[model samples]
Target: MPSEHESFNTRMAKAMNDRDFQAYEALLTDDYVGEYPQSGEVIHGPKNARAIIEYYPGTLPRDTLDLKSARVGATEARWVRTPTFTVVRAEGTGNVGFSAMQSRYPDGSTWWVINFYELRGGRLARSTTYFAPLFEAPEWRKPYVEQRGPTADR
Candidate 1:
């Protein structure tokens, strides 16, 4: 059986995937703020609820359900709002975050993603993630950047 923390994370993910605002409301703190770092968008309260409803199922899933979420503000992992449950950072026990390029689906294309979540009182206090499809850098910018990490196989 999953621990309560583990189960909480699972429920929130399901709510987002299923676009169940009420379920999410049950899991997220009433303040519930989500940030889209790439676009500098901040969604809060009822609007955040709407994002889960109108945005996820209606818009985001059409492109990628695997995308990570929010920046979590005060919050800004300066280590951000003190995470409570994160699958990537603390393996869903506490504090979750990861930046990786990986296959989100079996035999599917890879994506670049970063995600972090914070938990408070068994409910999500705040969370954030960013996602981008993998692509090769053009020759034009190669000289301006230094190589880093093990290169991903083409």
Candidate 2:
């Protein structure tokens, strides 16, 4: 059987993939913080967190996101996976992009995000995301970058 932490992380990932902000909000702590990497800006509280999700449509290509693996510690969980984003340009051009992200779940209730994405455009066009931690003083954790697969895995 999966642990409670693992189950929570799975549900969170599913909520993101489904774009169910309501469900996502339910999983968040009362005071949630959302971090955006491109601007290195942090959105504090659930209100800001909801705003970030609402405005997400304008930021990147929207597609079904898949959550691969999740690892949990005493009070934190890290999800490692690549999401396929279908990028759409204002000019009606569209393409698929893949980016790796590590989402930390504090208290198994809220999720703090740290993600890096590169669009077809230059570095300035890239996007970064950060979110609030569940604990009083959240520790600094590293982001998950994609690694080359072994021949057998490929």
Candidate 3:
């Protein structure tokens, strides 16, 4: 069983992954703040969650969320009509962008976004994130990369 605090963080993460702006907004504290140090972008409160959705643009295809766990239960379909809800997500942060090749970043592809969160009052007080599209190590870098240790034959 998870504590309420852990549950809150999980809900916030899920809302972000699902592109469920409404659910995400509910998880933010009144003073919630999000920052991208690489990009020097700051967004405050629940209103800013929209920016995330706009930039990602359904970037996360499959959603594995338990909406019932959220602090504010907003149905996916109804939230669309709410004015605050925007199809916004973060754009390329600093030097990073979504993807040049649509084929490479297909609907269900994995683009990793790592978030470091600080919780306050059982809600998201602040969070910092970095995102990058997943890719195979290039042939050129393989030489510089460390090789795995040899293992006994299975």
Candidate 4:
């Protein structure tokens, strides 16, 4: 049998794939903090996170999220989950967004929103994105583009 943490991650991914915001909302804690890359804004609380998702562009079609790998620890664990988001516009233009979430399973199955989503367009418009990191620690979190560097100190 899979661990509860693994099960929770799977369920969360499924809910997202289904575009069932209500279900997604259920997974989140009351004080969820969602980090938006494009805006450099951190949305505090579950209510705010839901509002942000509501304005997300491109109607979500197929929401198949696969758990690639997971690194478990005593208190906290980081998992690499990839959710392939298929979006379709009114003009019939389809685009795919791959979101790589690094979730920290605190208190076993209870998950927190550490990082996610690089928004595009001006506030309310289409967003085309690729694999983005979801940092667990606030201090470790930086601009997604910054992570792609060939500098002296990587």
Listing every candidate in turn, what is its Cα RMSD in Å to the true structure after a full C-alpha superposition? Answer: 12.3, 19.1, 12.0, 17.6
Measured by TM-score, how close is model 2 to the native structure? 0.39
Clash number for candidate 2: 8
Tens digit of lDDT per residue, candidate 1, span 1-154? 7656556656655565444556767776788777779999776864566554544212333233323443122323332211112233223545443222232322234455455667778766676767666577777988998656334442
Q: Please estimate how well model 2 matches the true structure, expressed as its whole-model Cα lDDT.
A: 0.41
TM-score of each: 0.49, 0.39, 0.51, 0.39
Best by TM-score: 3
Each candidate structure's count of clashing pairs: 10, 8, 10, 1
lDDT of 3 at 103: 16
Q: In model 4, which range of ten residues has the least summed lDDT?
A: 88-97
Supply candidate 2's per-residue lDDT for 71: 24
In candidate 2 the C-alpha lDDT for residue 20 amounts to: 64
- Order by lDDT, highest first: 1, 3, 2, 4
Q: What is the C-alpha lDDT of each candidate?
A: 0.52, 0.41, 0.50, 0.39
Residues 39-96, candidate 3: write the lDDT tens digits.
Answer: 8998887776666663543232234434333212235643211111111222233222
Against the correct fold, how does model 3 do in TM-score? 0.51
Candidate 2 per-residue lDDT, tens place, 28-143, comes to 65655555655678666555665565455222223432333332222134432322122111111122222333333222333334443222321112334544433432234324
Q: Which candidate model has the greater lDDT, 1 or 3?
A: 1
Tell me which residue pairs clash in candidate 2. Answer: 33-132, 35-130, 35-131, 36-128, 36-130, 37-128, 37-129, 38-128
- Give the winner by TM-score: 1 or 3: 3
Q: Largest lDDT belongs to which candidate?
A: 1
**Model 2, runs deviating above 4 Å:** 35-38, 58-154
